[model samples]
Target: MSRYPVKSETCHEAVDLADTLLPGNAGVTRAVVLVTDTAQLDLWRALLTGEARTSAVPVVLRRHDRRSLRGWAQRAEVFTTDERLERLHALTGGWPLLVDRAHRLHVELGDPDEVLRRLADMLADRSAVRAFLEATGVYADPALAAGYRSVAAEFGGDQVDTEAVVTAIACEIGDEGEARWVFACLDALQVFDREEAQLRLEPLLQQCMALGV
Candidate 1:
């Protein structure tokens, strides 16, 4: 079954592109396209893909695993032992940015544990990562501030409202149909499960989103 409600029948790219360029609602597709600009995303949503688009805004962070982490570690100058490297990869869920940051921290601090500790500490602080998480939470610019506030509120609350946080973030995206792709693509946050329709924020992301809420 499709992740969202839409018919999936592949059509000629030229035909689709031409229809997307023209004014009228001549053609649309359930196929996804990643666009950089929010304005362009809106335009695409209006003209070409409609609800099927997964905007590349806030750029998706691809996850890393042991093999990929080893490759990344090799590229970095840090003195990364296999044990330490594995620990770092597991801790960050192989999110490339975080992995890079952790690598830098390991190089600077000289220990994976130290790097993890500092990262944990950063998440503990209210202001440090809040902005970053909030910025990532947005699917649309108009709802940016509101999305941040919504996520921040959840952070302040006693319990971690996974559903609420995810739902609020989805609300920021104008189109409901495209929310799943957005959520699934959040490899950085590692919170949303596209298949299960679930949201379980990782520690770093939980703290960040909470602060953002």
Candidate 2:
């Protein structure tokens, strides 16, 4: 697994790069910070199966808890009612980035209702999200892109893609793999639902994509 490009690097090269990346390996710094999808992480571990694992610690950042989200609001001094906070929680699912963004907007607008409404609209705009992902070539492969569109239809309730996209994904690996394919691009497939103590898809993938993706 390399970077976004398909032919950029291989397992061996990445392993060799650990010398300059891991803590205290070079003059540049003691450690390296890498952000990648679950598939890349899996590939890295698989590459190390027969070798000793790196000493560098791995921290997985995920959605925040509802309670902690309140703390974020408190720190930002963005005062709002419980009902409004609940609405924000529903839109963001306690995703840290979204939560922070909401707090910032609340501070600017000084209207909880408007802040929450905008957040909802922002999440639901999949067309914009799709354009960004496509421009980045995040789903470059035709097959993979099709699979992504297929997953988007199911995950975000998006009805934009042609049926052919779904058919292509199903033909490649049937229903199950479509979701796994999505994980290849996203860091986490679901957000932690604090109330339920279970993982749930981030409310409607921004509504555009809870994908945080």
Q: Pick by lDDT: which candidate is best? A: 2
Worst 10 residues of 2 by lDDT: 191-200
For each candidate, give its TM-score against the true structure. Answer: 0.47, 0.53
**What CA root-mean-square deviation does each model show from the true structure?**
10.1, 7.8
How far out, in Å, is residue 139 in model 2?
A: 5.5
TM-score of 1: 0.47
Local distance difference test, per candidate?
Answer: 0.50, 0.52
Which pairs of residues collide in candidate 2? 23-30, 24-30, 123-206, 123-207, 123-208, 124-207, 205-209, 205-210, 206-209, 206-210
Clashing pairs in 1: 64-94, 150-213, 151-212, 151-213, 152-212, 152-213, 153-213, 155-210
What is the lDDT for 76 in model 1? 77
Residue-level lDDT tens digits of model 1 in 1-213? 112322223223423564465454556445444333233333334333334442323334446656777877778755368777766755665655667678778777887678888876765766656544544444344444444445445454333444565576677765544543443334233443222543444444544544534
